[model samples]
Structure formats: structure tokens, C-alpha cells
Target: MENPAEVLRRVFGHEGFRGLQAGIVAHVMEGGSGLVLMPTGGGKSLCYQVPALCLPGLAVVVSPLIALMEDQVAALRQQGVAAAALHSDLDEEERFEIRRAMARGELRILYVSPERLVMDGTLDNLARREVSLFAIDEAHCVSQWGHHFRPEYRGLTVLAERFPLVPRLALTATADERTVDDIRRQLVLADAPVFRGGFDRPNIFITAEPRETERAQLRAFIKRASDGRGAGIIYCGSRRKTEDTAAWLKQDGHDAMAFHAGMEASAKREAHHRFARGDAVIMCATIAFGMGIDRPDVRWVAHTDLPKSPESWYQEIGRAGRDGLPAQALLLYGPGDIALGRHRIQESPASDEQKRIERGRLEAIVSIAESATCRRRALLRCFGEDLEEDCGACDACATPPKMWNGTVAAQKMLSAVLRTGQRFGLGHIIDVLRGRMTDKIAQHGHDQLPTFGVGKDLPDHTWRGVARQLVSRGALDVAVENHGELLPTDQARPILKGETQLMLRADTVSKASTPRESSAPERGEDPVFDALRQWRRDEARNQGVPAYVIFQDKTLAEIAYRKPRSLDGLAGVPGVGTSKLDKYGDAVLEVLLEAGA
Candidate 1:
């Protein structure tokens, strides 16, 4: 068998594996089954991608997302690799051609969504192929206990039962100890070696403010961050948010796109294509947008709302700096963001068990928000891993925000709820505090309540903060279908009856920092470099791994500018090593010197 380094360089155009990847490639190549819990941008895809190429048959990837398959396939084909996908998107003719190719061993890796795999027909068709490896992406979805659980992923174990001779690798960016155990049980990976990569990305810097900066703060953050060094992603929580943010960003003269599942399939595909080509510098999307996106040189990943789990947070942030170059992660949390999350959970149609699990997930997210300790420490601990390095980049590291004991404000907000019969959302409650007797106020007859205008002593913004803080602390619950109809949690009973006291937070607005451009070397907006990176990413995709594992953006820029002429010359570059010279050495060098890399 070829050495791991040789295989990596030849297949992925890289000199060697980063972190646990070399070991992982070795294990998988030796016919070992394993579970890989690598953070996003940690080179998780390469563990199976390179080895699968060296092996003789198809490395069937049981993916939980179809968009992921499309993205990977498009990337792979761009790099001149023989790869295809068998998902619902393909027509019968397309599926038949792909199936024929798989049987003939023309395709190295074929991706299929787990929901499609669960069907007898789809599994039966793929079973006829000479399968060598079975790689499961988003393995956490196999467990119902995971933050984003998918019921269909449970059928993946059927592949193991059916293909006893093929080696397997289950991979995920998110999973705690319990979720990990659940994944093992569901996917039946008892014998797989476990490779857990550390969860810290040193390049990312985390900072948060109260929810008060919804539009204004977001606009300010975007303007300051887009110094035009490289592309970044701004993750919003909903479809509407994505559109609104994307629109606002466009007005600021930035090339941005809004991507969500709510968009038409054609529109989504176009958006993906644009983002992949680096034609757009920023994407304001829901979580769905990042899964299929394996782009390197994504300078940053920011969140406008709180993510549901540390696993999810790490995965989202992991999308940046895949090339191991410096990048940034900006996590913005508002008190209302927490409340909205809780209210939705409390209103879900889940069973008792599901509700309990959901609550646990919510609490875990809160722990990250409330953590005055190292953010990385809290995040890694939640995943059942340890962080030896203190993250000097997050808010906790730079300057921790002082905690607000909103006990009095909580009591006042709770009192308003009790007096108003607990039927209002934050806006109405705020109005009652500011004593604004508007038409809606009169329509609801809330103006007559003794507490209607009692909150007049506090500003509208301060009142809003108090109510949101109360909800985040669990003294109140917002009804789901009714949309933010406030109700008292059992904890509020003591405060209501005077058995316990409450405090209100006086929300403070921080002074805005002057906007500054990024300090990175200015890479000009040359279409040739953009084209070369897209070409390189395409090659990486067909091989079925992340593009960063193939070549970094800096290296891509070097190739685009200098156009290295020989293998020896290629090996002289910063990221290039001996292994890469042998495998992708000639091909990439050709593109660099002449056309595309």
C-alpha cells in the first residue's frame, strides 16, 4: 500500500494531513472502522476522501443533506475528478447513468441522503456496486438526542449490516458525550476507533451585546468587518432575517446573498454557485447554508442569534479558517434571542421525552452565554472533550461583560404579566412600561390596569431588557403558537407571591468603535484568482473532502499571482510539501503557471 502521505499528496494535492487526519487516513486505509468527532474546518472530510481514492472501489457516503452532496460533486468535477451524486435531485435518467457508473467503478465516491438510503429501492441499487468504504457525514443526526436530529439517519446501520466487508467512518462536527453514545447505538459503530479533534479555533474572536443591536448593531458589525480581505458568512436564524439582512448588506455596496431552505430550489442552486465562485463576498443565511459549504478562506463566521448547542456553535464557527490560516468568529447574543429560543422550545409539539431533551440543549447553549470563564473551555467541556489552550479571542478573554442581577426588573415585568393576565409579548409589555397609551393599548384595555403605566419610570429600552432578562432566567415562558404570549414559569410563583425578590437589569449601550479596515494584505479582485480557487475547490470536491485540505487561500493566491512552473517550484511555496508535489504537484502547477489551479 502507498504511504499515507503519498496518498494524501497524490489525491488531495496536499503534503500531509493536519491534526488527527494522517492517523485517521492510516486507520481507514488499513480497513479500520472509526468515529471522527472533528470540529468544522478541522479537515474532517479528508479522513475518508484520500483513502477512498487510493482504494479500488466506490466510497459510498451516507449524507444527511442533499445540498451537501451537490456542493461536493460540483467541486469534485471542477477539479477534473470522476465523481457523481445519487440524490432526489437527479432525474431517473441521471440516476440510471450514475448507477451504471458506480457499477463500472467509474465513480470514486457517491453521496446519498440518508432519507433516500432508508428506502429499499435506493439501497438495493447501491448494494450492487463494489463498495470499499462507507463514510457517514453529520453522524450526530443518527441520534434523536442530537440538537438537530433526523429520524431517517437511523437507517445507515443497515449499510453496515448489509455490507459486512467494507470499512466505515462516521463523522460529525457536533456531539456531546450522551449524543456520541446515542450516535454509536443508532449507527451501530461499536468497533470503530474514535478520533476526537480539539474544538478550539484560535483565529476566531467572539463578542456579544444585548439584543438591542438587532439591525443597528448588525449593520455596524458588518460595515466594520467587511474590510474586503476575504469572504465571510453571517448566519441569521430565519428566512425573513436572511432576506432582510442580505438586502441591507447589498445597500451598503457589499456583494451578499440570502440563502435559506424557503427559497426556490433553482434560486438556492444559483446562490450556492455564486457563493462557491466567490462572486459574492458574504452570505446571510440560516444554518442550512453552511452544511454543504466547505469553502476555505472564509475569513470569518458570525452569528446574529444564539445557536442551540455548543456543537452547532463550533460547527458554524468551524466553517472559517479551514486552511489553518487566521480567521475570525463573531458570536452575538441578545437576551431576547435566548427568550425566543426558550419560548419556541416550550411551544414545540414534542413528547415529554423530547421536551426534556430540548430543555437540556437550551440549558447547554445558555451555559456558553453565561460563562464568564473561558468560552472555549465551556464549549469543549460540553462536547466531552478538554481544552488545554485558553482561547484569548472571545469576549471572556478580551473583556468579560458584567452580569446584571435584574431581580427588581424581573419582579416588575412579572407583575405586569400578572396584572395584564399574562397575555402580552415584549412590545406590549414595553409599551405598558413607557406608559404609551396607543390605540392598541386602548383596544386591549390594558391602559386600565394599575401597572399599565407604572413602568413609566423606566425607559422603553430598559423595560424591554428587563422582560427579556426575566424570560432568559426562566421566570417566564412565551407561548409558541400564540407568538410570544408571556406566561409564568413555576419559578415565577415565589416572586409573584413575595416569597422571593426580583431584580431588573438597566441595559447599557456600549460606545461604538470607529470602523476600521482589515489588516490582511490586499488581494486585488482579480477574476483569474477567483477562477483558480474555484477550479482547485472543484478538484477537492470530486475527491470528497474539504477544499482547504487540498490548498489554502494564500497558496491559491500565490499560484494565481506567481504561476509556479515546476513540481520542485510548487514544493517551495509556503503550504506545499513533498507529498503534494508527487500527487497534485504537476496538475496544480500547470494551472498556476498557465490557466487555473
Candidate 2:
């Protein structure tokens, strides 16, 4: 049997394991079960794949989506591995052939959806064979505390019952402490060792702006980040917004496409294929579009609305810069998004305990967005990881926002909420604070209150910003049951009683600002790199696969910079594995020679 390191070098083309991959792979190869908590682009798949190659029998992997299964199978096959996926999209003949291959012990790795794996007789058939291990990808889906929960994942617990001896590896990119604990209990892997890779992705530049002229903000973000050279994804909160945003971007001369669950299957596939192939297309999509994507050179990800939680936000933004290159993440949100999020939690069918968990999650993300300190630190704190110092990559650390003493503003806002009996939303409270003579304020007799016009000096937008900051700081809460009323929390008592000082970001009260340039080192334009990318694009189109599957931009850039003249020199590049060097060595050298390398 080949060791994991040899398999890693000869098969996957890398020299060694990253972070906890080596230990995780060794543990699995030794017939031990465990859970893996690694960030996206951390090579989680390689942990299971390398072990499967070293093991004796077929390695069964439980994946969530058909697209994920197919992409992994395609990439593995390109590396000369006998991998196959059993999915509904495959034809009957393809399924039959895969079954035959499995029976004959020809396939080293097999990927199947959790739903398909738990089907009648599927586990029985697998048990009759020599199964090596069970790998559960996107393991967070099994936990109700997770952002994207699927009921089908609960059935996966039976894998331990049926294949008790086979090693099980549960993997996910996003999960808090609660979600992680829940995943362990739900998957029946409570005793399994947990390996947690750092949740920080320093390559991703994070920024958030209050939604002021959202369309214009989005356009400016795309232009600055992509420069018509890189791909991007804009996540919207609704299906209609995806379509509208896509159309608007296209009108502005961007290569944009809309993708949503509402689209037909064929349409979705085509959109996915285009996104996978095109170098500079922007995908305007709901949250449904990003999970299974394997594109490596995506330069940016933007959110037109607030994500449900910090976990979801991290997962979505982590999709960019998968190749460890510099990428940007811009989030645009407003009070409306916050209210809607709270309202959704209030209206959910979940029990009180679950609702409380979700509400905390919502508030956590809101605080991250409105935070005046290091954004990366706050985000990592959600997953129970602490960044000792500030990450200089986020917008907060890049260009520090001016902060002011908002204690007076907070007191005035809280006083109005209390005087109004906390029954009205922000708009009504703002009216009473600004001393606006509205019919509702007049009817409620708020004009008679001492705190009614105490905040009259501040503008409406300024008061709104103060209210949002107050909510984010846990000094106030939105009562969705009372039609989005503003209510003071226990923490508010100190501010209202002049016992606590409140500092707020000054820019939140001012006009929205543009995202700053990423602090990551910029790559200068190289003729060799450009020529190599063109050749790669053409070759990938000829082979009908994603360009990254052929040769990642990082590899091509390295080759262009190093100017590898011979096949041996080309083989020295990091991503140039034996299979790729053998297959494309001559062609790559030819391109280099033509470009005067």
C-alpha cells in the first residue's frame, strides 16, 4: 500500500499535506473515526481522498449536492484515479456501470448523496462489499443549529450503525461551537477526535457599507475589484433581486448571469457551466449558487443584503480566493434587512430554544457588520476561535473608521423607546426624537413627552445609525412580535442611567463610503502570464472542463514567472503533478517558448 505522502505527490500533484490534513489522513488510514473543522479552500477533500487511495477497499463519500460529487469525480479522474459518483443526474447505463465497477473492486473512491446512500438496499449492498471508510462532506448540514440545515442529513447517522468498523470523517467549513457539538451528537460521532483548522482566511478582504443607493454601490464594487478581468458573485436575498441585479449589471456592460433555485435544472446547469468556464463573468445569485463551486480564481463576493448569520456570511465570503490569492468581500445592508431577519426568527416554527439560538446568531452577524474594531476578530470569535491581534486585511483594520462618544445619542434613543412604551418601530421613534409633527406622533401624544424633541438636533439618518448601533451592541432589541418595535434590553439600563459610555462609528452616521483597496499585494501584468492564461483557456474549452481543473492560475503564474523551459523544469512547478506534467508538459513548454520564456 502506498503511503499518504506518496499518494499526495504522485496522484494529487502536491508535495505535502497542509495544516491538520496529514494527521487527519493518518488517523483515518489507521481505522479511526473523527470530525474535521477546516475553513473553505483548506484542502478538506484531500484528507479523505488520500486515505481512500491508501486503504484496501472502496471509500464511500457522502456529499450533499450532485454538482459537488460530479466535480470531485471529474478532478480525481483527471489525476488517473478510478472515481465515480452515483447521482440522479446520471443515466441508467452509467449507474449500472458504476455498480459493476464497485462489485469488481475497480473503483477506489465512490461519491453518493446522503439521500441516495440511505435509500433502501443501498447500505445493504455496500455492506456486502469491502468498504474502507465513510466521509461526510458539509457535515454542518446535519445540525439544526447550522445555517443551512437539511433533514436528509439526519439519516446519515445510520452509517455508523451499518458500517461500524469503517472509519468515518465528518467535515465542514462553517460551524460554531454549538453547531459543532450538534453535528457530533446528530452524526453519532461523539467520541471521534475533533481536528480544527484555523477559521481565518486572511486572503479575503472584508468590508461592509450601509445600503445607500445599492445599485450604484454594487457597480462601483465590481468595477474596482474585478476591473473586467476577474470573476465575481453577488448574493441577493431574493430570486427576483438576482434576476434584476444580473440584468442591471449586464446593462452596464458586465458579463453577468442570474442564478437561483427557481431556474430550470438545465438552465442552472448551463449557468454553472458558464461560471465555471468564463474568466470574467459575474454571477448574481441567491445563496443557492455557491456551495458546490470549485472555481479557484474568483476575485470577489458581494452581498446585496445581510446574511442570516456570521457562519453563513463566512461560508459565502470564503468562496472567493480559494487559491490563496487576494480577493474582496463587500456587504451592503440596512435596518430593513435586520428587521426582516428578526421577524423571520419570530415567525419560525422552531421551539423556543432553537429560536433563541438563531436570534443570537442573527445578532452576532449584525454586530460584526456594525463593529468598530477588527471585523475578522469578531467573525472568528463566532466560531470560538480568537485572533490575538487585529487582522490587517479587513476594512476596519485597513482604514480605521472614526469613532465618537455616542452615549448621549444612545440615551436619547432609549429614552424615546421607553417613553413610547416600546410599541413602535424605528421610524416612529425617530419621528418623536426629531420632533417631526406626524399624525401618528400627534395621536400618540408623544409631543408632550420630555424626551420627544431632545434629539431634534440630529438628522433622521443619524438617529437611525445610532439606533442600529445600539441594537448591535445589545443595548436595544427589535420586538418583531410587536410589529418591529424597538425595546431596550438589560444592557440598556446602564446607558439610560448614565452609568455606561457608548462609542459609535462616526461613518455609520455619515454618508456611505466606498470599499478600500485590498491590502494584499497586487500582481503586475505579465505578458507570459497573460499568454499562458489564454492557452489554458483554449485548452480547457477544448477539453470541456473548468479552466482550473486543467491548470490553476497560481500554477500558470508561477510557471510564467519562473519561465520553465524544459519538461523537467515544468514538472518542478507546485501544481504540476506527474499526470499533468506527462499530459501537458510539451504543450506548456511550447507556449512558453512562443512567449519568449
Best by TM-score: 2
What's the residue-level lDDT of 533 in candidate 1?
A: 71
- The superposed Cα distance between candidate 2 and the true structure at residue 36, in angstroms, equals 0.9
Question: Where is model 1 poorest over a 10-residue stretch in terms of lDDT?
Answer: 511-520
What lDDT is reached at residue 185 by model 2? Answer: 95
Q: Per the 3 Å backbone cut-off, how many clashing residue pairs does candidate 2 have?
A: 0
TM-scores for the candidates: 0.81, 0.90
Query: Which regions of candidate 2 fall more than 4 Å away from where they truly are?
Result: 411-461, 473-501, 508-522
lDDT of each: 0.73, 0.87
In candidate 1, clashing pairs total 18
Cα lDDT tens digits, model 1, 1-597, are 456677556545566678999889888888888899887767788788788777877888887656668767765554445778778878999988987787777898888888776689877876777777889998888887776677788777787788777888999888888888888877777767688888766665565556666777766665555546567898998899999988988898888889998889889877776676553389999987867776767877788888986768877888876656556666677655677777677778988887787777778877776565677777777777777676666656666445555565667778888778787777887787668988888998888877777777777777766666666678877775566688888989787677875544345575243312333434578666777677766776676554655666777776667666777666656656555555577777556556543
